[model samples]
Target: MNSKSELIKFEEGISLESGDNLSSFELMIETYGDLNDSKTNAVLVCHAFSGNHHVAGKKSNGEIGWWDEIVGPNKAIDTNKYFVVCCNNLGGCSGSSGPSSINPTTGKIYGKDFPIVSVKDWVNSQNMLTERLGIPRWLFVVGGSLGGMQALEWSIAYPEKILKAGIFAAAAKSSTQNIAMNEVGRESIRKDPNFNNGDYIELGVKPKNGLKTARMLGHITYLSEENMDLRFGRKFQDSNSKVDGKVDFEVENYLQYKGEKFTENFDANSYILMTKAMDGYDASKNFKNLDEALSSVSSELLIVGFDSDWLYPPERGKEIQLAAMNNNIRSSYITLDGRQGHDSFLFASEKYEEIIQDFVGS
Candidate 1:
């Protein structure tokens, strides 16, 4: 697929859900395929936490995109038939305005001073981007995990602008356990000495340890016990060596490598902000319940949850499906049996590729 990334600046900026305003801001977007003449075949693909706009195809640096497996020519998303657009969210570290961005007012990094952004705030900013692109409405908006929440918000916030929403491995609200996990991650970053209380950038330092620890913890929740056992199975990192209380297991080494690799590309402040945003999202908060929250939604929904996903299990997806049905909206729920846990949507894409293609095609 032909893909390109661009940074678009909006001088008018946007008002936040918190009532604050950004004087000016930018969005980093990557788009694939050709936009048909009627502009009616555009699909919006939202990214999960720690994800950016590079959703599909190869980048200039020869790095393949995150969702390339599911979004290429004649793939599940079918780039040959539809234009796919993804963005590094408003408060993201990847080329977008965030704590790492220079504050237009103070002429300094926003750091901890960056206004807290919500899922709704992200949808509002995305609306601006769609308007700029001259897309009156999207054929569909699809995402996994946090991206799924954004897809949910898009249908709620702008019912007229979307025809369908694909919510994969996500829930309508953050579970209590999920909130606790996020807090632990946030505290890990704040406690790092080099964090400097969110001002590490100016000090020419980074909270690498803290961020690495947080990533390691989060990674555990992303995989299922079966997956771990299958991959590691208490295997020793080195068979020739005896346990000396220094990372004996293969799992330990793998987690460390993943965590260390994460710190190199992601910003600590951005990680904190993104998790908090995810934790605070509750679609049913403004209404009586999930049913009422989805009452005004005009978009059809395809919600899929992994059976092994304890983070956001199949029941969570069922809740959204039932709520949509309660409001007389068309919805489908799928409980995919997989050992990949929360990440089954990506790792087990082949198992449900036809379902996705049919959903969009219908």
Candidate 2:
């Protein structure tokens, strides 16, 4: 086992009970600015699945973060004022533990055998990180998409420890439609002959084709038809449409780019497991009911949704807002015009950023 120091220098591995025999792990973190004696200015930013702890600029490989536009010294997550800590989720394939990590007994990668997890399990991990990093209380927790799910979980799980929460382009629970989409991607991986029951790594032949197909499919869902029309349209990339001289459509080219780029670093097994966990998120069942669950969330909230996010439409976010209101928890909801659909939050929408900045400033 590698010591905490070699694991990229944050608070490192901190374990917690996640109701299973397996001890769910967390990657503790720290950021710029001193935590006052009161420790109120700390902000915890939860990442979407497939996102790493890197939330700002380029990595050592010169790859910038997905949220680079909103997280920086003076950006929405402003390291200049409040300290920020962003963690990889419990089932993530990042610096923290996951299926890719080696199993102690078998001494091989866990692969498809990683334990299932939940939003509560994820929050429990972050709580360990918060404690290890000496952040007794958080000024706010901010995130979007799956990250936003974690943000909502933070408020419910540690109501007394957080002052406010920002949930953008997300649902209180993962939608069935979203689950079906993710399941289709997972099944694509499983159906690949190269998968070999998740032990294909030993064969030196990854299920690249099936995974690419899945990525291509997922890329389609992340975009709205309107956004696709504005960006890709029916224009041909190869400018050929006779007896199929070459592939046509700019949208096809865009999807190919997305798929090819995804397989470079992503693992199919990790994708499957994380999507499973996300699909299991059931906000209503956790408490007496949905309203009761929202009542348990005592922190102030900022909920933002895109006009075109059909995956978890703005109406879904309105239900969350109404839940918060019914419970009388401090909450605000905003909708931004975005044709890019659910992915607008990731693509750096100007209106999105402005609202996030306004909330962060609060």
Best by lDDT: 1
For each candidate, how many residue pairs have backbone atoms clashing (under 3 Å)? 0, 0
Cand. 2 TM to true fold: 0.90
TM-score for each model: 0.97, 0.90
Candidate 2 per-residue lDDT, tens place, 1-362, comes to 00011142223443333445343343533254456667778888788766767776656688777777787766766766777777766556665666667665577777777677776777877787787677888998988788888888889879988988988888988887899999899889999999988877767778887888898888887788899888877887864422233456777776777787788887877788777767877677658777988877889899989888888789878888999999988899988887888887776666777777777676
After superposition, candidate 1 runs with Cα above 4 Å error? 239-245
Residue lDDT tens for model 1, 1-362? 68888999999989998889899999999999999999989999999988899988787788778888788899989999999999999888999999999999999988888888989899999999999999999999999999999999999889999999999999998899999998899899999999998988988899999999999999999899999999999898985442235677999988887998899889999999899889989998899888899988999999999998999889989999999999999999998887889888775366688888899999
Model 2's alpha-carbon lDDT is: 0.75
Q: Candidate 1 clashing pairs?
A: none
Worst 10 residues of 1 by lDDT: 239-248
Error of 1 at 184 (Å): 0.8
